[model samples]
Target: MRAEDEPDLVRVSLAADAVFAGAGVELPPDDPRTLLAHADRVLVATASDGRPCGLAATVAIDGHPHLEQIAVDPAHGRRGVGSALLAAVRAEAAARGHGRITLTTFRDLPWNGPWYTARGFAPLPRPEWGPELVRLWEAEAGIRVRPRIVMAGRPG
Candidate 1:
């Protein structure tokens, strides 16, 4: 994605996530910018017409990779965009020699937790999260107002 795509990417991510989840779970204004700033890699999937359809970001932490955000435009949901973006993240992690990738999502949210679980991410005990990840979850807890489940997956 080009620098010009940042606003639209953030818009699509927030809008779609709100639709899929709910208003209270929406991303804050600086959240996408922060993710893009810290991520070692960012992958975006576009539709046949060249519109942004999905996005994912990955950052390295203590020799492991963390999948930061994965968002799919509601209009493009159930297509291959989400799966393809996640595959890109996994491939990028493996190429960087990371042993595993971890992420957190709302435990009871159908689209949030179940989607990742179906793609091979397994539930991880909150106690097992590294310091950086723990901090992230804590920050999210402040914003989301809903309990989240942490999950991790090893490269296959």
Candidate 2:
């Protein structure tokens, strides 16, 4: 994603979250900039009209990579945008020599935990998560607002 894509990306992300999560969880204005600055890579999926349809951000920690955020526009659901973004992030993680990729999702939501599970991620015991990720979960409004399942996938 380019520097100019941050606004649209953030917009799509916030919109998707609001639709799926029923709460307006917008990133801080500078959050996208910070994510792009620190992430191992950021990937976005756009529609034919060039509007961002989905996005994913990955960052490395403790020699493993974690998918920090992934969002797909409700209008574009089941059209493969989320899957493609995930594939790209997984490939990027493998290329970076990361052993595994981890993510957290709403346990009760079909589009959240079930989707990840369908894509090969398996539920991870909370005790297995690192302190950094645990702290992030504590800080995340959505995760704190609802019960979530943490999952991980090892690169094959």
Each model's lDDT comes to 0.77, 0.77
TM-score of 2: 0.82
Off by over 4 Å in 2: 21-38
> Could you give the C-alpha RMSD of every candidate to the true structure, in order shown?
2.2, 3.1
Residue pairs with backbone overlap in model 1: none
Q: Which candidate is the best by lDDT?
A: 1
Q: In candidate 1, what are the lDDT values of residues 122-142, reduced to their tens digit? A: 998877888888788777765
* Top of the candidates by TM-score: 1
The clash count for each model shown is 0, 0
Cand. 1 Cα-lDDT: 0.77
Count steric clashes of candidate 2: 0
TM-score of each: 0.86, 0.82
lDDT of 2 by residue, 22-92 (tens): 54433333355566677777788989998777889887654678897887878887788888888988888
For model 1, state the Cα shift of residue 49 in Å.
1.6
